[model samples]
Target: MHDLEASLLGGDRDLTLRDLADRAGPGVRPEDVQLFWRTLGLPYADTDERLFTDDDAQAVARIADLERSGRIDRRTAVTLTRALGHQSERLVLWQVEALVEDVAQRRHLDDISARLVVLDRLTELAPVLEAQLVHSFRRHLAAIAGRFAAEFAEARTTEQADPSALPLARAVGFADMVSFTRRTAGLGSTDLSAFVQRFETAARDIVANAGGRVVKTIGDAVLFIADDVVTGARVAVGLAGELGGELEVQARSEEGGLTEGHRGVTPVRVGFVQGRVLSRFGDVFGASVNVAARLTDIAEPSTVLTDPSTAELLAGDSRFVLEPQPPRELQGLGSIAPVLVRQA
Candidate 1:
């Protein structure tokens, strides 16, 4: 076990948990170190157990420095640590599993052998993946900074706003693939992967071109946001129309297997609403977000639906023809009428 630990960590194997804490220097509280460990999703180790390395001590020291400098409070530190832990854990699992599956299929190997292949490849892949993550994060951070700058400049021109109020009033929406489970039933890995990739890529392109941002893509749906209602409406309408067109084109194409006769194509339904939303961790949440999701569930394929409030706001738009749908009972939301939006 000690030899394995030495080989894996590539460091002295005699440092206990308490020894690591002591190496972090003074003014780093015991509780703070424990909290950091727990936030990183690590189980508690006995204080006397040699389970940590010098790198771990350095990380704790860096976190302590950040906290001491007032750059991050205790709560924020925990949140940051937890986010890193949770997101990285999921990402690492996903990447490793994808690699294992590919190796298993290509080499006709058993599961254990495939995993061994993954382990062999990980050392070569880790640094590349880390660099890519950092590069992507920097680019994303730049975009976020630019957005905030533009938004703050706009806010300065507004009248009598509370300084502490959240800065953005955005439109949030959801677009869900209809009959997803039924459509993808009995599909092999390659076919299913292509289908989902096609949908997500198309959805993202549609949203971006319509001046909206895709917040995230779920298996059979996407969540998006835009700076204003008009942009949001355009995104919702474009997603449905464009996806529908893709399906039609696929149905007409003479490709084989799943691509034949729209066997791989899926129709999408969209719902959008304009309101103030709370943005946290690159995701939006609020009543409007819930309403948008609910509306998408009730929308028909290749169509867009909006709440009455949103419809009222968009009443006079010439590009859209709005039709009133009968009010129906919705779970959790109770009875409500939704407006069907058609592109003119």
Candidate 2:
């Protein structure tokens, strides 16, 4: 009773931590209350400092109750805070217009007009969007971490993979839109928006359907990697074909005015190479990856090209027809002859 009294009337009614404990009821302990604030990364004060307002106290008390009920822990609470902070930093840095546009669509507003409104009301009207973005960022980070842990753990536990794990051979590939800069420049804002969206959609669908994992999407291209050479070959072929078809469709559409007579919507040139790659930070590296990207750069529009190794691996695959092109003096890479693929 004395402690409760000390808390309630304590510190000249400044609504400090002690006062918060007093309002939390007789059953709630002050230690747990303090821990709750600490978990929230709020400063702990011993003096008669008004660190927590009534609302803050109530929130802490509720969180404490949730903790006691096995809903969360001090560590988890801290992680949530850190994760939220990191996500906020990224959102502020990127100014991702897609996020704002998504909210606009949900609210039945025109995306373009809503973009301006979203910019103006970001701090107020889009709390839900912000929260969702935070949640997504956390989930992605966790997933990536989990995958890394699993891979490393497997490497350590299995004699076949060693503590450090020998790098495994994989087929790496890249598909990039040719003349993307020129095409985008020729487009209006609305057309440019649709063009980028259609390209991404097509790329993702093609990559996944061909049993390849999309590593990342640069502005006008996507990178993919597959475990086997055959899968990589199929991925390249499928991606090129899909891009060609989509480009044709897009060219006929009004938004595709930039591609009306240019054969296709900046046809994606794909290239693949089979070799060892280092997977880290949700990305791949090594010479093979580099070569694949360079190959994509040199490939003709709407075509799939592959290094000699990848072509050799898929030589027996009757579903594909491969034809070699003349040796080109690729920069950074010595003389090389790449094979182009066609449907059989």
Candidate 3:
């Protein structure tokens, strides 16, 4: 086996496309295997080359078994395959790049050599990564299951007892770095990466500690959501006040340490809204998301803004103070008043 194939397939390059299909047992057609392969985001060719592995064959066989047992229909099977493919493609690339960057920095190697080292390291780390992935998937699945169970119980006890009408209420928010483009315009790759990493790490820590989950991070902004308004409020306030203040202080302390033309501090503006959101594909959407993002666009550095609805929800809470802002016309969203929030 060639080095690349051996490294990737773990020396399992004995089976061809035809052989793999046969090994998947009866009722599993070559076309079915092709479909599975394509659904996994892999390009397929009609050659009899020994390019497939035992693991690949077994995986296809398991899918066939699932279909035969009626555990999943063909459409569902394809969806599951696509989801795994889509997510894993990005996951593997991110992990590999991270490893390559570490190797390059630590050993002072060129990009080519760094990639070669990363490929070698991956062969050794693959099993560990796989195990960790499985472990984390189970833990996350358990959390989702527990949440659904509790929500279903509550729904059953409610007067309506109708799941369709009462969608899940959540607090969605955005925290955006101020003047990100101008701040990083002169930074080299290394410095830019460091700056982004610092912001992302700090933002994630603050959001997680405040009982909110980060949905995603754009280049200069983070989107987060919480099951309750109070938790979201805490996250917003923490990011704008505590975390933002700390970064500012650090920037001042390290001002002399920075390279010329590089900014030391990352200031962020945050906005939050509490309302029902349409959750799909591990992302949240709808007007609440739009409003929160719009509010973030208008918020000043180290400050949090919320819509009237969120302010009302948080009004009775002594931990926060809300001051109403003048009605401002937002693009796409009509004229609306927002409230500034601060820790009491």
Candidate 4:
């Protein structure tokens, strides 16, 4: 048992399921050891005898401690473990894809050979990369664990509510092109690619120039969550105007003809709203994102639709003309009254 305990406590290389069963004593069968791991939601399939890492053993010990302390019900613990496993799988897959793409692009290698090289290089660099990734992953996990631990303790202490609630902040919004998929559908792959690139470049510059951070781009949409109403409003209006103007120019250049709404090109619709948001994992969530996206869907090409709250924020701004549209029913949000804004 002492030997088993020492081996299990040491690190990745020395730990094994055999050590665990030995420490668990004579009556604890190999199946029992394997079942214990399964309870923690690890994706590992355990034979009657299968090896385990020290990290696995340590995690199991922590879960056991929680059970002994009555901190979590067994069912809830199982659910949490499963959720963590799913998230880990997603993060791993995203990172792997990112790394593969990065290596391929950097080396300018063709597909088949690039994949082979990626695997070969990964094998050679596994030790160093693993150590670094483990360190970072553990730190992030510890932070999340600490937050949950604090929340659990608060929940236990308070009858009505927990004091360790998530922090709140000011407004957020997203800007997206309307009918972008439909509009680009008629375009060939090369033209479609150019159009998308132009949209991103214009949106990014306008957002940054207007004092907002481009959180990320999702297809035809760009999510920009600002710390305050002013910043969010600025970003939305700037993006709409700049992208609209650029599209007009690009359209004229392409067709070599001038007409109404074709002074230069077609334009994109943008939407903005101001509300609390949940920022997580390089993404923003909450009603702000939803409303902004939905509004964009309904907006006319080359227009900006803003919620009442956002309109009020820009009430006195001269750079835009905000014209109120009648109250309309929207999915999920029911009835909403918004205003269209355009550069005067």
Best by lDDT: 3
Task: State each candidate's clash count.
Answer: 0, 0, 0, 4
Better of 1 and 4 by TM-score: 1
Q: Cα deviation of 247 in candidate 3 (Å)?
A: 5.0
| Candidate 4 local Cα displacement, residue 185, angstroms | 6.0
* Each prediction's whole-model lDDT (CA): 0.82, 0.72, 0.83, 0.66
For model 4, name the residue pairs that clash. Answer: 247-265, 248-264, 248-265, 252-264
lDDT of 4 by residue, 1-344 (tens): 44444343354444466666555544544565565666544545444344465666566666556655789876666666665666667666756655666676688766566667766665455567668878988997896587568657775686743345334344555666766666665454334555776788888888878767787888888877666677776777777666666463223224534323422354667788877666654567777778888888788876778898888887887876789999987789999998987665
Q: Model 2, residue 44: displacement in angstroms?
A: 19
- Models 1 onward score TM values of 0.84, 0.59, 0.87, 0.56
Cα error of candidate 4 at position 73, Å: 8.6
Sort by lDDT, best first: what order? 3, 1, 2, 4
TM for candidate 4 is 0.56
Which is the better candidate, 1 or 2, if ranked by TM-score? 1
Q: lDDT tens string, model 3, 301-324? A: 999999998899999999999999
Candidates 2 and 4 compared by TM-score, better number: 2
1-344, model 2: which lDDT tens digit per residue? 34433343232335767777777666666665676665544467873576555666666566556656779876776566554445455556456576565666577676677767765665453556657877987997897687567667776776663436338667889999877887666555545666888788888888878877898889888999886788888889888877866353223344433444443445689989998888764578888988998899898888988877778877888988989899987779888998888778
Candidate 3 lDDT: 0.83
Q: Candidate 4 at residue 60, lDDT?
A: 63
Every model: Cα RMSD to truth: 4.4, 10.2, 3.8, 9.6
31: Cα error in model 3, Å = 3.6
Candidate 3: how large is its RMSD?
Answer: 3.8
lDDT of 1: 0.82
Looking at candidate 1, the ten consecutive residues that score lowest on lDDT are 248-257
Error of 1 at 270 (Å): 1.1
